[model samples]
Target: MSKINHFKGVLFDLDGTLLDTIGDITYAINSALIVVGAEPITTSQCKGLVGRGLKNALKGALELKNREVTPSQLEELVPQMLGSYHRHPYRHTHPYEGVEALLDDLAKEGIALGVLSNKADSLVQPIIRGVLPTHSFVFIRGDKEGWPSKPEPDGVYAFSEAVGVPVDQLLLVGDSEVDYYTAEAAQVDVAIATWGFRSRERLLEAGCRNLYSSVEELRKEVFPWL
Candidate 1:
């Protein structure tokens, strides 16, 4: 197969793309749900809820429990979940197989790296530092006041600007339709990591192309020089 290696920078999605954080996220969500008298959801269910953002995840969890809450109520519940998550963020979270080696190789190739997630900025920063301390990223951004979330190009543009890479030269690697749409909106190249929250079939169903089954596949196909 022909190699594709035109990108100078990569923007990764945190939750499913680089790290498998469903366990801790599920724990936090369940903790908040139980406190609110709502039924707790399974880890499998939580996977479908995440990648959008914590608020959305919480909302989805409540829906799964057949409970509905107003926006104000949701706002209040988010902090509870956040507190639970902060207590033990990395309890079961870790980078995917071959992810560290991929990052190391990319860094050596002088490829700018950045992480952008819909997860809270406070949470995203610590997770990366704690989990992948060896790798240096140009920026690690997550949801915060005034910044729009993924599928909205704003974060993607910001990442491009921060890393000093043109949008055309940047590749957004992620594991969900949200990521695919984010790249589409930003007009940047996108490669979906199927080993993430969504399966290859699910991503394809969502109209995602350029799918890679693993970090190794991605490295070989997108960054052959590595």
Candidate 2:
């Protein structure tokens, strides 16, 4: 095992890291976009924009195919989008294959487990509970009103503090630029989850050094102590 994997805790980004939530996100986005006379986005298109939180994700999806939604239109549509997601967050959402086993192995290693996402705080727990009921995480937080999301270090700092783990001793595992920047800002090591939303090329372009291609690979590298 690499020395960097010897972490006190492992913090994950929910959308791309822990769960394959792109389908539901795409569906909700399209459902809401149609309400404003906009075109729908594909699941692939939604993957690239999944982790940036509500507004950014919506904006990216709206503009994906040269389709545009003004700030005013987006603001007006936010509530409908939120409501759609809240009502059907788990319609097509599920953990990446072997994620449950990977989480179990990490638990056996006696390391703290946490989830920090740009998804709404209220939505995070319910989605987790529905999709990953067996895994026990110590910290599951999403974008609370006052806290900045990932790529800003605020969420990472909050996770470290909440879990009582030193920033350097935590492994931030994710699959997007936001996740990469969060680790960079907080001065922590990162493991790129290849099975998540974005492309591996994008992660590599962003200078990701640790790439976990599968759950078995993740178990070997990140929780080998088990």
Candidate 3:
């Protein structure tokens, strides 16, 4: 294996990277679709729609059913979706296999950890707290007002500053092209976790080379010292 660059901090993408949140996300999307009288989407379909943000996912869900939602219409529907999701965020969501252990090990190794996700801040904090309450993240930020979402470098930059780590000394671990682009724009190392939402083929086509098929593989390769 090639030598992995040492990182002082690691910023993880929440939805797919750390947690298997598709069940709740899909539920939210379908709830909004129902409010708009559109047919619900399957989990697989929802997978392709996520990674940008909930608004974009809702818009894509509408498009899948040949329904084009106006901005005003979407504005009305978003609350219903968010409300439904909030009611049952943890009903189906949980940390991915080995994720809790990995986080624990990383913490023990003195690695600063944070979460930077495109999911709404309201949802992100609660979900992380509910699912992985034991781990204390240095920073947990999501899509909030005045903060640009990822694939843009703003979130990553903010995370680096918040964690007191330079961009080059940080690693962004995620599961989508959006995450790959976010790391690229921020000039940080990125490790793509294929066990999440996107397939290895899709991630590779997005120019992601450091692909980890499993959490253990990621630990062994990226933090071999642990």
Candidate 4:
């Protein structure tokens, strides 16, 4: 266990780290694109496009194929896409192995837990309820008006404030460069999940402080301080 995993509370990054919702998101995005008379993208393509908010995700998906849609076109299609996802955020989504157990163990120890994601609020709750019902997270926040998402410190800072813990007392767990940047911007410790979107090399390049290859590893490393 690395010394960095020790912390009082944890703020988790949702999309690629805690839950694998990329398949469902990809389906919705492709459907929206088709409705807009644009081409569709594959699940693999969608994985690379995630982590940022939905707007950026869709923009990246379109850009990957050299397809460009106006901001108005994207805005018009977003609600439909999100509505589709809201209807079935977990049909093809599943928790990474050991995540449920990890959450359970952490909660048992009275460690604070919260979810911070670029995913919209309406969609994040249902997915969590569907996939991790027993995980007693203290708060689950999503992208909102005026609050900058990950890669910016706003969400993490807000999370720490909500948890009644100092920013330095929290551990940010995630799987992307954006996550690392969020932790850095918040001046908190970070634990990168190997099972998510970005590669370990990419995470290191982004200045990740620690890495966990599995949920069990995360539990072992993080629970000691509880």
Candidate 5:
């Protein structure tokens, strides 16, 4: 493997990547489903539904319920779903173990960090600022009207531009296949976090060659290079 310092900047995926917001998300979606008279899904099902953005998550919920809801109907349902989610955003949310220390170490090393998330911009910023206050992040990309969400590379490119770094020097760290594919599309190096949402086999199938089983492993394999 190349030395850790070889990477100049790192981009992170928010949901399932840096923090576990599953509880809030699952509750919100399930509540929406129930209110809309669709079947409610379990937290386990919700976890798999995540990472593709709120709209996709809702679609997954409908799929699980075996209900066919129109896109227009799903759109109408989004506001209430998100409102319920924001009400208890941090109720059961927390960083994965060792994330804080690893972030601290990276900050101390003067590495540039950024976040790109399918999470709406409204939510991504506060969640990150609330969770990791000490370290300075170069940029963050959240859902904006009409902006393509991941597995597309636009957000990655935006973050790279904001950080004034080439995509080649950027490393994307995320916990899902969406993150891996986004990095691949953007032509950046990637690290799949096993500590997040997806399984090791799934990550491998998604074409993620670099995998970190723990935050400490990330610190060892990636921090030194940054």
Candidate 6:
């Protein structure tokens, strides 16, 4: 395990990796589903739906194909969900226990940190701000019109450029298959966060060999120097 000083930079997935956003996400998802006359899904169900971005989450929550969920309906549902989330983004959202301190320790070690999420920056940025009030990422971004979501290598390059680091020296940490694919595509080392939304078995199945069961575990392996 490399110490915090070993890596020039790090990139994190916002929702599942850093913040335990399942509570608010599940609430928002259920609210949106109800508005659309659809059945609500459980928190566990929401866990499977998240990490892929809002559109995909909506699809999974409603159990509908993309085509079946009309664009017009999505237009309505998105705003409803956003409004609900924005109104109470921090109501139940918070960084997983030790992650806030880990972020601080990384920053103190002069390691540049960045955040990446499938939701648009418009949504993810504020949510992160609301949750991680005591820490900050050097570069934070989410899906935008031109920016491709996770599993796309462009986001990795974008974060590297933003943080003034080379891709090879950046460690991408996330909790899903999307993160694994993204790291592979970007040709960077990735550490799977088992404390986040996904299960240890699932992340391993997704080819994530480096798993951290808790925030402290991650801190130990990635930032032992701190």
Each prediction's TM-score against the native? 0.96, 0.93, 0.96, 0.91, 0.93, 0.91
Give Cα distance to truth, residue 26, candidate 4, Å.
1.0
The deviation in Å at residue 9 for candidate 6 is 0.4
Across residues 12-60, which tens digit of lDDT does each residue of candidate 1 receive? 9999999999999999999889877997899899888888898899999
Q: How close is candidate 3 to the true structure, as a TM-score?
A: 0.96
- Which sections of candidate 6 miss by over 4 Å? 1-5, 64-68
Judge candidate 4 against the unseen true structure and give its global Cα lDDT, from 0 to 1: 0.81
Give the lDDT of residue 105 in candidate 5. Answer: 69
> For model 6, what is the C-alpha lDDT against the true structure?
0.82
Worst 10 residues of 2 by lDDT: 1-10
lDDT for each residue of candidate 5 in 1-226, tens digit (9 for 90 to 100): 2334667688888777788888888888887888678877887788888887887898889888988878898888888788987777767888888877777767677768888888888888777777777768888779888888889899888887787888888888999988878878988888889887788988888677788898888877776553
Candidate of highest lDDT: 1
Separately for all candidates shown, the number of backbone clashes (residues 3 or more apart, or on different chains) is 0, 0, 0, 0, 3, 0
RMSD per candidate (Å) reads 1.6, 1.7, 1.4, 2.1, 1.8, 2.4
Q: Which model, 1 or 5, shows the larger TM-score? A: 1
Model 6: per-residue Cα lDDT over 99-215, one tens digit each: 888888888888898998897678787887777766768788888898888899899999888888888789999988899889889988888888888888887776777788988
Report residue 221 deviation for candidate 4 (angstroms).
Answer: 3.8
Between prediction 3 and prediction 4, the one with superior TM-score is 3
Residue pairs with colliding backbones in model 6 are: none
Candidate 3: lDDT of 203?
80
Q: What tens digits encode model 4's per-residue C-alpha lDDT throughout 61-168? A: 777767777888778878878888877788999988877777777777677899999988878888898888877898899888877777889888788888898876
Give model 1's TM-score versus the native structure: 0.96
